[model samples]
Target: MSLSKLGITGSEKDYQLWISSAEKKTSYPLTGHEHPYGIKMSCIPATGLLQQQLEGSTSASALQEAFLEGPQELQDQFILKPRHSARNQARKQQGKVSDKKTVRKSSLKNWAFGCISRTREVNEHPCLPPTKTKQLFGAPLEDVCDNDTLPTPILDMLSFINHKGPFTEGIFRKSGSIKSCRALKKKLNCGDTVNLNDVPIFVISSVLKDFLRNIQGSIFSASLYDKWLDVIDQGNDEDKIKATQRLLDQLPRANVVFLRYLFAVLRNIEQHSSSNQMTAYNLSVCITPSMLCLSNSGSSENFTKQISFIQFLIENCLKIFGEDITCLFGETSVSSDNSNITDITDNSEKVAGM
Candidate 1:
């Protein structure tokens, strides 16, 4: 049998874990004379022992054991006092007391080298995990949604502009301060809540000449586009092919809700934009014009009209059966082909996440 079978496979690294463990167990990172791996620690002469074990010895295990058992001279070579001293004395020179511990330059170099080796080994191992960027959601769309959900301009408005009053110097910094989130969250402690199913609708029972004229075939989400067709399929098959002059003219109060909601989100951000993205853009996705119109005209007629319009719109949306219906409250919609009439009458999902 090869002598290697009886010998320790050794290196400074091989000893490191052992040394550190011993230190932790014994409360001292002691090495050499009392170390468990070697044997001649008590018997061999210092100079001869180093040479014999490294290049001259044949009986490896006995040599290692002897090195441990009688390595008396080595004790003084590293210690601050005579060979029999149990600990090193230079430790006091380094201004350490008690279970004094320190890291040396050599130790750090070894640590970095070992880290690099392990990482390289891991890279070579196909089963190892690839490095990744952390995100709240695993999917990129969700990440994008998390990142760019509300536009930057909108968040700035809520945090700064709207909250800023004459007495509010540095309002964003003041209210969005770390402390504010705590106070606000405490006041708004979360509880399971029934979502409000309130949405004012706008019923346009006419040929949307106004919208067909204004929108230039820009909308692309296939599901939403399908829902738009279903909405058009609406209002009395008896009301089909009816005439209108312009796009906004045929649209319900879409523009009004976009403007108001934009303003509300802005108020939360504390920025006042005389012109908001949704509010300022006369051209928006098809829903924009209808929602805007419902919000603009004032009077009980408007409120009654708004409620009737939302109900009608929701009804048409049920025919399409989609998540876009939830978009009325800025929530993500689900995929369904035919929604139930009672589904929308409940309106629970409509108010969720608000």
Candidate 2:
């Protein structure tokens, strides 16, 4: 049949009328967008099916029967295109998508937990020296694993999460979701040389620390200060813990495990509080809330509740993964010269041989 015979050059009214008539006769409706006749393209399988059904069908009744009784597979080929199948599969793999602003909210909650809950002892310790203090808080950290440079969009996204700018609602109150985490994961994977899928726990640890350190100070730095202060003023310990746990539960399993290891490692590092000056407490306040509280953010009652949530997280991590924390991540080996020295720290003050 010629292009004009299919009514391709004429108005779409004829095409719509034909579609309307076909739907009334057939059990299943035909599906496709009308194409321009000038593009002489034939999808062989679909065209072949139509040709097979039309051949030797002289009467209208015969043609209708031929089309309706066509092989099930052939009918499906015309009804559903390959591209449509592919698009459906893509949507299925990625569940519901949360908006960028909401996804950033998840990062903000995680950031707050890392900065506020994890490091209480360090902030109050009296003996840390000046340089050590700066190293833990102010100094820019070198990449912990092979100097992997994270892309700028990831950092910008983190800033948005941190309430750095372009603010959104419920910064401190609402928790993140698994859907949001997966969406953010896909975002991080895009254009990334190192795909984040099944990444090593240690590398993830480095990334988490880098993320926590960088979440401070942007255009909207003071953006959520007042709201969080309101949260603090309420002093609702139960509500805060519940909210924090909801955020933690929404995190990917890898992240939950990484946080456990990260906190333990940071605590170990802070054990040398006198030497390194980065006590666990000081580390907790590392993110430095923009709220204009007189005392350091750690002194607030809200911070105390946050610490309780941190303990809860650690307990849950232990319950879930019963392995010893010391053996999991590669431990920093003691120097050969330092091997001969007997460590007389508080935890090891009374050695068995002594």
Candidate 3:
């Protein structure tokens, strides 16, 4: 029942793994965890959604109908499965089993294939849209994996940090820009208690880390970033094609294809920076180090080049995930052992002006 036992006081590494795995729909048991009924250990759900998809109920066309007609609560309950898992499960249920051993082998093969597809989907389209071209998958926007849109406030803050923005020159004008908390509160139309940390910086940081991890296969690997940086530096036709092929091999086809177009747009932005009254270098620097954890370099120039691609990533994310990307932030209330982890969004209905 202790906080330490629940992993609140665990080593920073363990805490991060626990969190990242949770995002991937993997379970981690919290020993000595307290439930409302009594003192007991608890395991996280095997799937991100609390409920399972009903038989023949989660198809793209079906999901779209449900989204249009179903209640918000119902929408929240629906779970989207990877295409590979769905196909394999269908095959297993339909195929004839010759023997117990054969069935076991089939199951093992299906599991392995399913895992490969799952990893591919995550790495390629960590923020894929519910619908591809004509059908919808009914994915929920509450979870970071399923959700793609950056919150307006977070976008504002990022713009603030970068100086130049997707839309504006940001909160700071020129260089030295400081305002009192009171002045900021009034300007931003926030309460006295609101601070920079009050924004969901942690959640945004976590999402960025997850995205990078999926693409690179491991956040600890410097080689992946270095290779990417090399591509940026070289910028030759042959090198670009080779790098594009490599990424397409690793990522989802849709993502790879979309990114091609995205990069085109970014290139145009860089080329016509003078028209927009902002230099390409300045524009790039404002968005680098996509997340705090991925801050691998101290050089602004290098970070600037790296950030150009991520800008497209974030903008594309908005298209994939839809607009609502509300995440929980702030303190937890722990009056009892049975208490659930509190997110500020839990009370969103009651909290006005959020």
How many Å off is the CA of 80 in candidate 1? Answer: 55
1-354 in candidate 1: lDDT tens per residue?
112332555443333221212122221233443433433333324446446545666576665554443234331221111222223433433353333333322233332112111111223235656766432111222221332243222222222222222123222122233353333323222212211122100111011212212222221122233333343445763242131112223222323222233333223222221222222121122233333232234466444443443333333332322324333333322222212112212222222233
Candidate no. 1 TM-score: 0.20
lDDT of 2 at 91: 67
Clash number for every model?
59, 13, 0
Best first by TM-score, ranked: 3, 2, 1
TM-score each candidate: 0.20, 0.25, 0.26
Cα deviation of 30, candidate 3, in Å? 22
List where candidate 3 sits over 4 angstroms from the true fold: 1-167, 170-223, 233-235, 252-272, 291-354
Question: Comparing candidate 2 with candidate 3, which one achieves the higher lDDT?
Answer: 2
Candidate 2 local accuracy as lDDT? 0.34
Query: Which wins on TM-score, candidate 2 or candidate 3?
Result: 3
Instruction: Order the numbered candidates by lDDT, best leading.
Output: 2, 3, 1
Compared with the true structure, what per-residue lDDT tens digits does model 2 show for residues 1-354?
Answer: 222322234333322211111211222112223332332324422445446777654564444344334555432222222234435644653343322112111232332112111211233345556552122111222221112222243333322222111122222222345454444444443534443333432233334334444433311123433443443334455554454444445544433343444444444444444544544444444323321232335566766544443433333443433345433333333322322322221211111111
Per-candidate RMSD, Å: 21.9, 23.2, 24.3
Question: Which candidate number would show the highest lDDT if scored against the true structure?
Answer: 2
Model 2 ranges off by over 4 Å:
1-210, 213-250, 287-304, 307-323, 335-354
